[model samples]
Target: MALIITDECINCDVCEPECPNEAISQGEEIYIINPALCTECVGHYDVPQCVEVCPVDCISSDPNMVESKEQLQEKYHALMGKQ
Candidate 1:
């Protein structure tokens, strides 16, 4: 599943660079994750780097874009160039 930044984000810009997929971005007053590009670090890393580095620990699973492991891997493959 993709991760999301909650309103608790402190706008510290800590989690943006930690994302392997470049999915994190600055919003009006906080950070937002692009669900289409977020694979929860499936192909690039073992865990969600954004969540690992988030200062406020505001990054959490996005319920709106729930996906299984296979589905997430498929999405990663499509984005990273594979069958």
Candidate 2:
């Protein structure tokens, strides 16, 4: 599943750099994750790097954009132009 950054984000700036897909960015008042570009780090790591580094635990699975592991892998591959 893709991850979403909650309103609780402190704009700490750590999560932004941890996202392998460059999906995280600074929003008007907090950080945001682009579901279109997020693959939950399927091809890069076992876990979502942004979630791993978020201090307030503001990052979590995006319930609305849920996808299976194979789907995530397909996304990862597509992002890298492998599909």
Q: Name the best candidate (by lDDT).
A: 2
Q: Cα deviation in Å at residue 12, candidate 2?
A: 0.2
lDDT by candidate, in order shown? 0.88, 0.91
* lDDT tens digits by residue: candidate 2, 1-83: 88888889889999988888999888999989999999999999998998888889998998999899999999999999997
By TM-score, who's the top model here? 2
TM-score of 1: 0.94
Please provide, for model 1 over 18-40, each residue's C-alpha lDDT reduced to its tens digit, 9 standing for 90 to 100: 88778889998888999999999
* TM-score per candidate: 0.94, 0.96
RMSD of model 1, in Å? 0.9
Cα RMSD of all models vs. native, in order, equals 0.9, 0.7
| TM-score result, candidate 2 | 0.96
